[model samples]
Target: MLTLQIYLNRITTQHNGATLDYRGQFSNSRLIVADFTQFVNDIQAALKSAAEKNIYTPPSKLFGNLRATPICLDVREQLADGLSPVEYKVLLETLMAVCNSRAVKPEQVLYHGKIPFQAA
Candidate 1:
């Protein structure tokens, strides 16, 4: 099974930054490793594109908090460095947990390459 404790630093228009925690878990039986790998690959590709563009756009309002420009810069750096399987799986689980907690489908939170912006 995979587990994640996702912290969403919500950056609303009124609040610069607000930290929130969300927890979720998925078993190996629930997640096919190949699908997870493809998902990560797609994210990697999108990160590369965002790096070239110098900005990452959020797919949904739920991720708006993580939309700060500096976060994207950091993401670009992280993407350039590359992610290991463990990191990628953790990321996948974190996102899944966040979506589950928010009652938002994972597809709704899709922003393959863009940074999930958080600001304070």
Candidate 2:
């Protein structure tokens, strides 16, 4: 399986008119079903869609604590395959652990299992 790691930095304005900062990272690991390049394109497309649609609702608890612009994101992913059973198991466990992690919201974690290729 391959993995994608995304790092983001967000600057938000607090209700009291102060500035709040957030820096964090997340990952999505899955088996490579298509060529590596294609897979990357698909992921980027999904992330872009999510961002454009404003699908990621910053946790309501943080309302009034952030601004809408100046959000920066960096992404990277593992491009190789052939993981040992132990490694794969650890990956799956990690995926599960973050599946519902408070640190990362479900919408913020963008993923689509299938990569669309050009029509044959």
Candidate 3:
């Protein structure tokens, strides 16, 4: 099984758009994304694409900070094996809800769930 946990720490709204500071645990690997200005829109687009294509790859921008690292590959591999397109859509929807909600506290866990590995 693979597990995911995401937390939002702060949001800065600028004249152009909002930027988010967040962190996440993809199974056992931890990562932080700072000043992610297009998080909401990007995730929504990803959700749409995944629905149409029946596959999901975490947005490249979402892990920009970890580019070229083994962790990025690990996350992609785990997600591919552990979740189906339908399951990934659900996860993206949960992420969208968390990003849209004002009631969330800083650093509060936005999502935490297990996804059983999909059989080949």
lDDT of each: 0.32, 0.31, 0.31
Which residue pairs overlap in candidate 1's backbone?
A: 65-117, 66-116, 66-117, 66-118, 67-117
Show the lowest summed lDDT stretch of 10 residues, model 3.
Answer: 68-77
RMSD of 3: 15.9
lDDT of 1 by residue, 42-96 (tens): 4444434443454334334666435422221112122333433454445546444
Q: How close is candidate 3 to the true structure, as a TM-score?
A: 0.24
User: What would the TM-score be for candidate 2 when compared with the true structure?
Assistant: 0.24
Could you give candidate 2's per-residue lDDT for residues 2-113 as a string of tens digits? 1233322221222233333333222234442223334334444443444454533322345432432222222223435433344333333333332323232222322222
Per-residue error for 27 in candidate 1, Å, reads 19
Off by over 4 Å in 2: 1-32, 57-120
